[model samples]
Target: MSAPDVFAPARLGPVTLRNRTVKAATFEGRTPEGLVTDGLIDYHLAVARGGIGLTTVAYLSVAPEGRTHREVIVVGEHSLGGLTRLTDAIHETGAAVAAQVGHAGPVANGRSNGVKAIAASSMPSPLSMQMVKAATEADLTRVTKAYVAAARTLVRAGFDVLELHMAHSYLISSFLAPGLNRRKDGWAGSLENRARLGRQVARAVRDEVGDEVAVTAKVSLSDGFKGGVTTADGLAFAQLLEQDGTVDALQMSGGSSLMNPMYLFRGGAPVKEFAASMPLPVRLGMRTPVGRSFMKTYPFEEAYFRDKALQFRAGLSLPLMLLGGINRRDTMEQAMADGFDFVAMGRAVLREPDLVNRLQSERVESGVCIHCNRCMPTIYSGTRCPIIDLELAAHRDPLPQI
Candidate 1:
């Protein structure tokens, strides 16, 4: 079988990707005490050597308070040794590396970190159901500096790309959502106000990294919650980032922390009816029902957003990367045919580290990802893929319960 256009070379800002396939930022439980472990480095190297154009390191926290948990890799100036080694291993496999920088905000595990979780307002997360303290002006400033410091560290570590994680109910996404951010201050209320922090973070990163590194944003097209950030708002924010001249590319995703488990992991629901039977109230104003129904009929191998991703792309002039359930050559080709510049895969790489190489050499008929979402639940338990039998072959011991 011939490889599709997705395997073709493309430009992601200043860096040139060998193919459109990007290993989306998926957390591995290997980072211990904010330092990269040999297991993490080897995991990424496997994906890189497997033939991915780029591999993203997950949850590289800009600040200790922003950390989702203590196990996540810290990208501050103090934690460069492990990061540099990780990047070197990926580069050795001939794959470009991108770091996903984020702040967990109110979603940060307060019980795990023993620190007050902060957000745009004092709203509680539906998932964790914990109340977050409203961020003070000083807190916001400190977080912004943390992001800049992290980006500078990534550049120093020789990473080719930096992705600001502004989606999935993180600090930035929480601030952007009207339902989450009810503050009357300058950082809240209106769309422009909600986007202020993200814009500032992008600018600060650009200032720190300059033209040498590519800067991109992973933005939620819809929060999948009532009165939250909408596609219209996302389009506006993408324009804002573009106008600021700091963002090099845009990756579009949907759903907030409260809604759509399938948002990040496409095809996780065993039966299509299960996805259809999900409470529509949870999806509310977003066009999730329509998109979900379409996914049911099509069942593409790539990310779930491949079909509707162009809707967000059409609204922006910059390069757009589609993420979700992408896992096959045909689906990837379709994504390119529809104008997506990149296809981002998460669980596919988790299940089969050499998926890219196998696909390129026609050694595998299809990706090994079963889409069970067992990997997602493991994030809380210790963030490695539980279903990846071979990857866990060495660790036959029982995992500690979360």
Candidate 2:
């Protein structure tokens, strides 16, 4: 009969979190040369200091060809120092740290990585306009090894959590979606077969990490496109993940950056703002009918994923993390009441890193992000809200560095 406490400490696998809030992974374009930077550490430090259970470092590519950007952090010897410092910095703030590891699949930027982007099958990427080649069996084996290696690296660097990314239409997500993964091989066709790569990665990472850290996964509840993975199938996939006995938790997310990104987070799409951040050619392309189709807007609401995530909670016994539209005490409380073990936030934390602290102290009702999604384009430059970082606005370049 009482509202569940959103700020109380909770168990997340091998670690005990200070609070139930998690700083969800957001791509920080600060990393250059596929290595860590002071900017990246500082970003997470702010979130950790603001008071959250864990802050996830975003999108570490397993292989160079899998990278969406040339400057994305690659789990390698060269990045050890930066990664260590990032974990140490978050730890100093008394917070757990996580790294999101995955291959970009068709989303891989051929212009940036100097290699043809890969997918479950040969298909042209709607976002990249690059033809993706089907990954060979050898490629899958190498990628699995890379996942294990990356998990080990994160644990060695003092991270408390490792989030295997199987969402957002990435390589793993592509395999899960029949629309993209048209292969007749063992890795395609049925949902069980399509989920093989993701399950393998989760299992490999869990095996490598042993018990040193919590291993979780992010899954797309829906591809938000027709003929894509359906909600019924997504629930089945979530059950499959738990049955696989690899990940400690399941985090729900959706939307395809290559298709309906607005579906991921229901909100206003800053089309002109996105176009303004690109080069002349890309800018012109954005103005075209085809380019304009990429930025479809969706209505914003608090706890947008609650209904869908609640279905997952009802069907599975594994701990689930509720994400999307968690910007206030009420929404966070709703998640806790609905049986989600943890709540993950991105734009809310980005706008106010201390939002968790504010919620705990009862200082603020909710975050003031406005759901404009103007900050979306800044991921290509540096992910800072235009409203909060005035300096960035003045120096906004015509072409954001890819």
Candidate 3:
């Protein structure tokens, strides 16, 4: 088959996106009360209006206890009304909507959540500075049910896609990583055992949604550290998903939200700025060498994950979306040429919500973003480009004299 057009319509399972450029999921930090707020709605509306083919609402927790923090929206009956409104607004802008659903696992903030976090093994949670409990068989069953419930809620909210988040060392991903999953049960040891949770969750969601919506997954291509999910293991798990015929596409990503987040981002880490965003006690700790080492920096490169994603592309027949450091039009077209079905962008679109439209019109200048990654720290407040906010502030009329 010929290479697909980057600017043309593309089908993601039952949903046909206006184009192949997706506004990749980024934690919006807008749902302060664990419910849909106006800020969350407007955050997606801006991206939808900016002409993204699909705008993904990030990190919606499958269960209340599964949240990364208390502020994350839990997909259930309580929040269904607000979620429906949010999706309706986005659809009106001619863009399809996706909700990224997952359990934070060891990555959850136990202190903020008022519940003990669960993981494949008992471990420390840096976010909550608390010990994470090893997930029991009962917990795993509950989580699978939670994923199914969330999938149904998303479909009812008029979402065109259900992006299962099985990456970033979240619940299912921790099970995949040998470093994190020390279980001696059927859910661990061998690759098939370790991969069981992710495959189970995907199949359950697919079964619940059926042909009503596109089902995709943000799959880990690597955990970016030795003893974590290696490239070989990641590729094998992706092929298994293909074999299961569950996900319509896989959005190949890297790094552990638990171990090494910068491995996926590939740019400046902005340690001090990140420190300032934390609480007083944690802020002081982040200044230490130990804290600095945890948030390590990686040099920036365009299409940083392309080489890794190609491995999965070669191994699986299913569609794949290449993510990480996709900023330029040429890069997007090059990805299509290289056999990727779509390109997903996060920071670049955060810098310019209308970037897809600008690239489509051939009016964009490349490298408009500096890749300093300062925007990442702002996820604690509201995810945005601080530079753009500054520029807009400067151009605004001066405040009236006190």
Candidate 1 Cα deviation (angstroms), residue 45: 0.9
- Which is the better candidate, 1 or 3, if ranked by lDDT? 3
Task: Compare candidates 1 and 3 on TM-score and give the better one.
Answer: 3
Comparing 1 and 2 by lDDT, which wins?
A: 2
Q: Model 1 misses residue 354 by how many Å? A: 1.0
Among the numbered candidates, top TM-score falls to: 3
**Which ranges in model 2 have alpha carbons more than 4 Å from their true place?**
1-4, 279-291, 390-402
Error of 3 at 53 (Å): 0.2
Clash count for each candidate, listed in order shown? 10, 0, 0
State the lDDT of candidate 1 residue by residue for 1-402, as single tens digits: 343477778888899989888988877777667788887888788889889999998878888768876676767666898889899888987899999998988657654555767888886443233556899999989999989888888999999999999988789988898878889889888889999999999999899888899999999877666766788898888889988999899888776544444555555544433334333432231244433432222233445665456677777788888887777777777777777788888878888888988887877656877777656655543555566655668768888899
- Which digits, one per residue and each the tens of the lDDT, describe model 3 over residues 1-402? 778889899999999999998989999989888889899999999888888999999889998778988899999999999999999999899999999999999888888888999999998666776789999999999999999999998899999999999899899899999989998899989999999999999999999989999999999888987778999999999988999999999999999876788999888888788878876635644545435566888999999998888888889899899999999999998999999999999999888888888889889855488788899888878888998988999999998999
Q: lDDT scores for all predictions?
A: 0.77, 0.84, 0.89
Q: Give the alpha carbon lDDT tens digit for every residue of 1-402 in model 2.
A: 775577888888989999889999989989866788888889888889999889999989888888986878888777878899888888888999888888998778766677888889987654455577999999999989988887777777888888888887789988988988889899999889998998888888877887889989999878788756677888998898898888899899988866668888788888878878765545654555546677777899998888888888899999989998888898888788788889999999999898899888999889888777888989878898888877566778777678
Candidate 2 vs. truth: CA RMSD?
Answer: 4.5
Clashing pairs in 3: none
- Candidate that scores best on lDDT: 3
